[model samples]
Target: MCADYLLELASQLEFETVSACDTRDILEQLLESLAEHSAVTDIPVDEVVLANLHLALHQLDAIARGRGRPAINIPFHVIEGYLLHGFNVKEISELFGVTRQTIHRRMNDNGLRKSDVYSALTQEELDAVIGEIQQSHPHTGYRMMKSFLQARGLLVQTTRVRDSLRRIDPIGTEVRALANRTLRRRQYSVPAPNAMWHIDGNHKLIRWRFLVHGGIDGFSRLIVYLSAATNNRAATVLEAFIGAVNKYGLPSRVRSDKGGENMEVAQFMVESRGENRDSHITGRSVHNQRIERLWRDVYIQVLDQFHILFSNLEREGMLNPDDEGHLFALHWAFLPQLRRQLAFFMDAWNLHGLRTAGSQSPYQLWASSRHHEDPDQVEADYGIDWEGPYGFDDLGHQAGQVEVPQVQLQRHLTEEDMARLPDPNVHFMDAIDIYKATLQQLMQPRSEVDEGGSDA
Candidate 1:
């Protein structure tokens, strides 16, 4: 019976019914007796050993039946944060890698609850939405913030959003609410994203190095096109404007400040869209607030560092403000880098969540609001989504992929014209190649060669 019991104990280990931690002495006595009886007559097997075995098996059996399975525990704050970010329970479960039952239990245990109103209005979404507005247009007060959110399908109480804005940015809330209690402001409206576009040039950095020209859809606030060129010429602006038109299809109206640099754009809009239709409107820069507002963020977010760097270079005598060659080198070298920064800003701005145009990013607004008018939803309208928000069906519009169509319209140009056109979207390696070649030529010490390409 002792040997049979020992065999049974060994068999239990094979079937994984043993708990090594709980029954650490499972074989202690069996091994001691075996060692003591080595090379001698077998010691009589006894109930003491059998009793110990029975106790060990009982302990192992209890552990095997007990509930000691590994647990899945996620922090309450983490779930709360997800709820605050407008994630539904399903979404949170997927994020936490847990079941809905587990989530519900956790919520109940933590004394947290999400109401039906929370699911519908997404109050946490409002907090984020208002925060985005305060960030982009810091001067926007709480009342306007409420109107903005309500306009964009977020129907939150004014008091609620007001409190959120105050919480998110107390200083901005106090300062904006206190200042400009009354100011004359023109009413602005656009029926849709491509209904009208506002274009302008940012000259704040003109003294530093490059000039940035950009266009924004009035409704969606999408940065249609942003490019930097060395000169603020009419042709340059026209080229970018046309590029935008080709990419986004043509806008119903193009608004700009009455700068001569925009003459070509105005003419193009008038010619393409017709002057009788009010296709182009020129006014004071202040009246063209759509694109003007974009410049503030662009300068602060992207160009500020470059401005300081350039200013320091000039002040330190590393770059002479008067040297034509120095300016040329600056243009050739820094222009590409500036274009990249502008590209990043364009993407960041276009994809940034908006306060006024719903919580949707500019690109999202553009996608949803573009094709709401023309019933030819099954087709293209200069690549337009006419007849109501016929967004990209084949593939979603990526933020960084916003580019003007390179379709050379029905026009003829010489090689000189083509070469004179700025390629802001040039490949990085190609620019580096040209940069090195240009640097080599500029830095060449040609003491041995004469002007005639011969030794003097």
Candidate 2:
């Protein structure tokens, strides 16, 4: 159906065999020539035709915006006419609702004025370098090439090297951070909401420091936006929690790190707490857990995304050339859009993304319960006779004891895996130290005092 509709629409577009010279002439003079051509043609359009054209043009405008294309105000009528004549300046101006002179001036203003005279490597030198690369590391990209050249006393920017390679061969750069690692998946399944949730902060400094409070439902893996703020104050966190509670309703509980600030955050004193109590309903309290493993993963993901977003924006020159103020403005203005995009990502993660355990998404198990059983037919299902299971029933329910493994996880259990110990305080440096200490203890038959209790 969609394909047929697109084909039908394509058939309606009038095609013209524009002369090559005409196209070149239009390109040379741009909109100035188009306006001149229109004046000579004496073609007049009414308001209705103009309005319909404007509406149609809006669709394209939306596409451009979605593509991260910069916005400009230009005259649509002239630009539309120019496009009809094959992307002439007059039509572009009309589309932007700006004059031809204004459009041209703005284009020049934003355009890169850098000279192409790269001085570091001449064409012959570049060829020789490429030959060496092909001989040594044939598969290396421009970044590797840049590093290789630097070691050989060639002062060439990676960008310059990349550009040169593009001219000589099909070359592309795959942006990757050195610190990235593939983490083994550890899945946790909770039978109900409040069983568990992952919480972490994504911090950034565009102009001012900002933190995004993110929490993922353990069962559904649905993300709950606790808050996003310019400051990482206790109050800011509280406000975010309030917002999340208001949206998702209070979960039976929340699990987070035992950071000093969060430990002191009295949710009842917060506005959301008062409001919920005023409605005469009880609210859930926050729960702490040894889920540092999950928080570490969450923090890395948030920081990675932040770096990728801004890095791309900066590299693409989406940042303002004159004043850096545009960074803050652009980021804040796009905050809502970012949130929506995050939601889309979360959905993808929950539905299709593989997990560490059984390689299944959280959403898969969420829809079906593993231990579901009918309560009514307890006796027959259990296969308990009238006297109960032979041994237990005949013995007349003797009082017996069963030992339970205390919920405390054993510390430094294995020699080689001692470094896996978790820190109670959730401090990054402390966590690393604890991990190393545990690994040492596991590898050697030695015991150390729990630093968490002794230090703090």
Candidate 3:
């Protein structure tokens, strides 16, 4: 086309006498041709295009480059979508199906870009948003926290929050860091919740010390068991677990840390802990190690901040700043006498604690099994059919009087399941030996008792 046009121009004018008017007209025609090419095809002629093209040609001159210069495959949908939406970096990136960095480069090439809009927000608005976010979720990233405003009809994007957040927050760098999931290489379980259970311990410093041991039902993601005590001992662990078992029934498997309390020999015997075991505990499971580490963030970051606040007050000779000082004093003194209190709190945690995720108390989850009552429905006599709440006595009476429907499940056991089931194994023998040792320890009575016959 170029050759044909040049030939016609040369014929129309003098062959060698080139005029400024002719050159300008030819250049304009070439520019129009290039513009038409950009519109028709996504050849990715952006800011970097000319310089990159020149570099490629120069490199090819030295050594024939294999493969054509890597032209970015800019999809047409991206460009059209950006134009329709009034292109912003994030929207543009979304249009191009690429990152903001890509959009930034594309805009630079096209010479159509704007400075970040987050900076345009007033200081008061920024403070209000940031304050609300911090109050709601201190641990949440700025990007994630922006949805609070967006929910209330503010045009806040995660990126905008992220940029503005950096200015006001000292931990702005950390906030941005958290936005990116760089450490997503951690293992993920199956998609379903009931596929795995995560258990862990956390130390909570309230009025008194709390060693929180908890279990979540894998399928329900419900708090099956929660024991908050002054101490996370084997006995407390057993009680907490027993409560969960009595409530939720035995899970397919129980997962926990290798802590002495969780991996207790006696507890394992009761559970028959192993893969494919007939015992309460199931086989092949992931443990609560992840949650345990998450607590480091909670304890060090959340609780530690409180601790610092209190410590600063003490250092300034202002003990009991507000009523919190009394609470802090109680906490300081109560840590020592916390063990006995833990036993009581363990039961309370199961029965009274509210769940942050579900907004239902642990007791509510357990009590959901109770029968429904229809007060509106009346008998022939117009007596309200108030099925008395199913308390322990009611359950006993119902069991004795009426036959509740029972499901009898039957399945042919696989070899793997059979092998996993507990029976007369070497461990069982060792358990017997341990029991004998315990008996000996108990049976060795006091000297006076040993000499005497039966007690008076």
Using TM-score as the measure, which candidate wins?
A: 1
For model 2, the local distance difference test gives 0.41
lDDT scores for all predictions?
Answer: 0.61, 0.41, 0.42
User: Native-vs-model 1 lDDT?
Assistant: 0.61
Give the winner by lDDT.
1
Instruction: Estimate the TM-score of every prediction.
Output: 0.47, 0.31, 0.32
Query: Model 2, range 26-59, lDDT digits (tens) per residue?
Result: 3335335434744775543233234433443454
What lDDT does candidate 2 reach at residue 354? 37
Ten-residue stretch with the least lDDT total in model 2: 376-385
lDDT string for model 1 (105-223, tens) is 98999888875223354657667877765554455566545545543545455468778887788987777656545533334556777877888777666664477889999878888
Model 2, residue 323: C-alpha shift (Å): 9.3
Error of 2 at 8 (Å): 60
Could you give me the TM-score of model 1 versus the true structure? 0.47
Ranking by TM-score: 1, 3, 2
Give candidate 3 regions above 4 Å deviation.
1-129, 132-139, 143-164, 178-184, 204-208, 214-251, 258-288, 310-456
